[model samples]
Target: MTTQPERLQHLLDRLLRGVLLPEEAEQLAGAVRDLERRADVSDAVAKGNLRHVKQLIPAVRAAEARVHELEAEVSRLTAGQCTHSLAICETHHAKPVPGCPYPRCVAARATGRAATA
Candidate 1:
């Protein structure tokens, strides 16, 4: 059996190896990990507007995943992107956008147009 520190070390190693660590294994889970947190997002996603919501989901997931991947890479260059529960990104756009940084995500709001970039 691995000690907690050993397990944590293994988890970090896996992060370096481009593997996703399980939620149970993370030393700390981020805000995105919280289930009860009511997100403040755009009306399109919250109103269940399909046109704008579809494109945004993957982009958001890719960005968030990329951030974690980068953090793992900075400390260890051997790691790559891992799916794990993060793959549940497939289930997201699950939250609405309180604010969009993307021009398309923003344009979709400004004119009520399907903003795809």
Candidate 2:
């Protein structure tokens, strides 16, 4: 579910970095739609329009936080830090908190292979 947005963002980020083409601008609509849905859902529960109030209320808050995080990640990648070390890359591994970048085992495996090679 969350994978689609992350994949699209990565592809779009690359395309923009390469040429900033209008073709790449084509994704704006879908992005806008996604954000709109997120916002609408959030507002519905927040303003007391939606049912299942107790369960939905928390879900809405979480969605809002996700929007903020995605916005920041877009900002960061747009600012030309996309090529930074994965160790420091935001959202690299999807750890609930920040700074997970990637798993330690992947690095360990790579190092193990390199040492044997």
Best TM-score goes to which candidate? 2
* Tens digit per residue, CA lDDT, model 1, 28-106: 2442343225454554367777866887999999999999888655423211111223332223222212244444434
lDDT of 2 by residue, 2-117 (tens): 48778678757777688645665567556777889999989977777545676688998999999999977864553243245544333343322222223442343445432112
Off by over 4 Å in 2: 15-18, 49-117
Colliding residue pairs in candidate 2: none
TM-score, candidate number 2? 0.30
Q: Please give the lDDT score at residue 56 for candidate 1.
A: 97
Q: Stretches of candidate 1 above 4 Å error? A: 1-48, 77-117
Q: Give the TM-score of candidate 1.
A: 0.24
- The clash numbers for all candidates, in the given order, read 7, 0
The alpha-carbon deviation from the true structure for residue 35 of candidate 1, after best TM-score superposition, in angstroms, is 36
Would you give me the overall lDDT of model 2? 0.56
Q: Model 2 Cα displacement at 100 (Å)?
A: 62
